[model samples]
Target: MKIRLLSGGVEVRGILLAAVVALGLSATTAAFACEGGSCVNGLAYEAFGPAPGTGSPLLAVFVHGDVSAGGPADYMYSYARQFAASRENVVAIALLRPGYYDRAGKRSDGSDNGRRDTFQSSSNRAVSGAIRELRRMYKARAVVALGHSGGAGTLGVIAGADPGLINGLVLASCPCDVPAWRASRGRGGGYASQSPVDYLSGIPRGTPIVAVTGSSDDNTHPELASNYVAKAQALGLNARLQLVGGGHGFSSGVGGAAVSALGGMAR
Candidate 1:
């Protein structure tokens, strides 16, 4: 894992820095369409398997964690690409969340502003907008959302506001309970508004969902995924929790787990 201090002054380590470099290096691939300034709602994105607007079986969008140094889309590029290659006619996209990849100095629909709401409706709107645009552009028959860590919080907001918008979800190492997690971290008053657990009932029932976490993850405990999946299942949602090896960060088997889970989603 090569660590690099990004030009923005954030110390980025591991495959994230490599993924960032991949974005710049793989500009000629099918996934690199947005590198020429083609962005949706000011968000930077890369596509794989098939180009958007050409039609495909599904559009699987991967959203990464809230990291200051690397783009939100950086960490999941390989996973997205691998998944795309495994399936026929699947369009994989890695979308950079607001403030992370400001293409041509354009902020992603008010996302760059520090005052932007974290997990509020505004944040959800930003993510949802990107997904919808990509979905429309690709003419995909179905949509799958893959979110990691804080991105899972954004996924929660999207699921809560528009349950039917996406067909499947993969939330990995999520801080399922924002309030509880915040309180545990000694942050009083907790951002309960951003918690995924709070929006359980809003997610459309039977939406194919897979929530996985590292068995030894201390950042976001494995119990968070277990408890959240329990609640989701109790609500008649097709949700399950899987404990994998490793810690808060990505493990060796996470990509395979995600690909297997997503491959099961109906097209």
Candidate 2:
């Protein structure tokens, strides 16, 4: 396990390499929460802002997609940077280790043979730890969680465990039906049964959540994103789904739209 402290470009490179290696056979985890320190085996995250002096009441926590940690081409970071530049406090967090999606148990055929059923729970725990740490480090007027793909699932877990920790949630390209998805993947167990929608259903009304997905994201379940929005609405929570352009990965246009939506909610 290797940790990269936020500092110069060289350290970022080394940390990225370590994250890639750890994500072997699993999804890559990247976290950016607060700014400060370099602990052994633990990377320090920093927030970007305008003029390095102005501050805002909103703080956004961004979780990266599968096998990705805010590295180059990662839209999570791009949007976070944009928000920070606009004067919103933003923290990005990478996972402690690679996530299970990128790497599952292998089969003799040399294909991706790993089981997707059990990975969701494990990833959820990892993301929860990061969230707790970020909350402690930064006490903002409002907190929003932005997750894409596998990261969105992880955020669901966090919201289920503690809904008050974040003021709102944004799930992009998320597969809502965990049991069904796992089954479709040819795994015996159904989609990871643990989903935020299930837990948030009972929360008091007025919870804010937004689900976003691309019209072309074929990798995820067809109705999962819409289902999430519907569930949130049934619970009397403030929820909506946005349709964007592109596949699974982040695109500039989609990222901008997400950032805009988040800003609206934060205000």
Candidate 3:
């Protein structure tokens, strides 16, 4: 696996829980005009297994981190595809953050703010909106979101501010403390983005959250996630930190850890 620096993207009930563990999925994408908050279907995604409203119990959403301006901005395809392939009753969607385009050239609406001033409210709102729309579309019993790098930062905020939208969260190599990260990057004033740690009070205590970081990752260091998880625990949230062998990019270790979290949610 090619490891890059961290950067950084669904449902169901009792019957659905059974569906997620047993596993077979049918490829599906039932199109519809859906809106979440004010984004108004501004996001785009690649879906796998069971069309919307299929009664799938589990919905997993994958959001990739900041990729430079180029091809493969939506690089979570393999991860989402494999996730869907492993479960029959689950639907996985690899979402494109605002202003990002997939390999096939499908672009999501909304501004990426040059893709640097990201994880801001607008970006966070759009992502939360996308997840809301996806959940409604899938009629899922539970929703799990897996985000990496900048994507993880976004999900972290959503997991707090819009806590009701997701049941489980997997954050990989997250810059959970945005202000501190900006300070380290020499941006003394900090960007307009909202840090995940600032919004932790809103997350419910029962929500399952996990932050995974590479043991040797120089970028978005392990302490970022570890500290965030620690604070979360202080707030009585079910959160933990997982350290694995690798540099700063997504790996099979991160994927397995995330899938394991999803399984735990099912129970």
Candidate 4:
């Protein structure tokens, strides 16, 4: 892969290009819209905390699970609001349309529609842009990323693009091998052969990461979180794994724990 060094760090632009080619994704498919308290590109992002006041330490970017954006019922907004209220700059992003992955007979394009792939590709692009904007506009000292399920993979892609952009990551109930899951369901194009695990390998050491999983989360194996932690540890990253007592849905206590863990890292 082609590697370009910038400011003493390697930029894996070629890896992203290869990933796009392997997934059969068009570079132009990722579009964005930021308006009226909503930043909806591939994902819906909302910023909080006084519009980047005079001095802010960092910006926390949140990525929600497989759902559209709304309010407290929306996990993305919930976490973003929680962090923002806790004196941290925050931005919440919703990356998938409601029921985008539902295999039931509810799609307008029938069962053969390629919705998941479209959603993932678009979300990744939007997140990349959001990170760039956060750094430029807010002068964020570091970026703390919080992602759930498929959103975790989107964060993984952004991490690959600019590892230095992220100072900490919180992954809740993430499906570690998303590309494999998509392939098993014949949605192979959603991810490339180079998985997020491979991408994490290149991240700088001491980049703190927390992998949270539900003890009863059958949808995403708890082992998946452990695996990510293990990989991060192998790469010399400051990574930790936690198991909360709940399913895929977020619990009040678990959410607080995740935010606290990430906050400590950012500080």
Regions more than 4 Å wrong, model 2:
1-46, 50-56, 68-75, 88-119, 184-187, 190-193, 202-204
Residue 168, candidate 1: Cα error in Å is 0.5
Compared with the true structure, the alpha-carbon lDDT of candidate 2 equals 0.56
Q: Is candidate 1 or candidate 4 better by TM-score?
A: 1
TM-score of candidate 4 on Cα atoms, chains taken together? 0.68
- Candidate 3: Cα lDDT at 189: 72
CA displacement after TM-score superposition, residue 58 of candidate 2 (Å): 2.2
Highest lDDT against the true fold, candidate: 3
| Alpha carbon lDDT at 66, candidate 2 | 56
Q: Which residue runs does candidate 3 get wrong by more than 4 Å? A: 1-40
lDDT of 1 by residue, 14-87 (tens): 87667777877775343333334557865677678976566566888888776644443376778788888888
Best by TM-score: 3
* Deviation of model 3 at 141, angstroms: 0.8
Which lDDT tens digits does candidate 2 get at residues 16-91? 6756767763541122221235111232233544222234345677766554343232335456766666653544
lDDT of 1 at 190: 26
Lowest summed lDDT window (length 10), candidate 4: 104-113
Minimal lDDT window, size 10, model 1: 108-117
Candidate 1 collision pairs:
31-47, 53-137
TM-score of each: 0.77, 0.66, 0.81, 0.68
Name the weakest run of 10 consecutive residues (lDDT summed) in model 3. Answer: 25-34
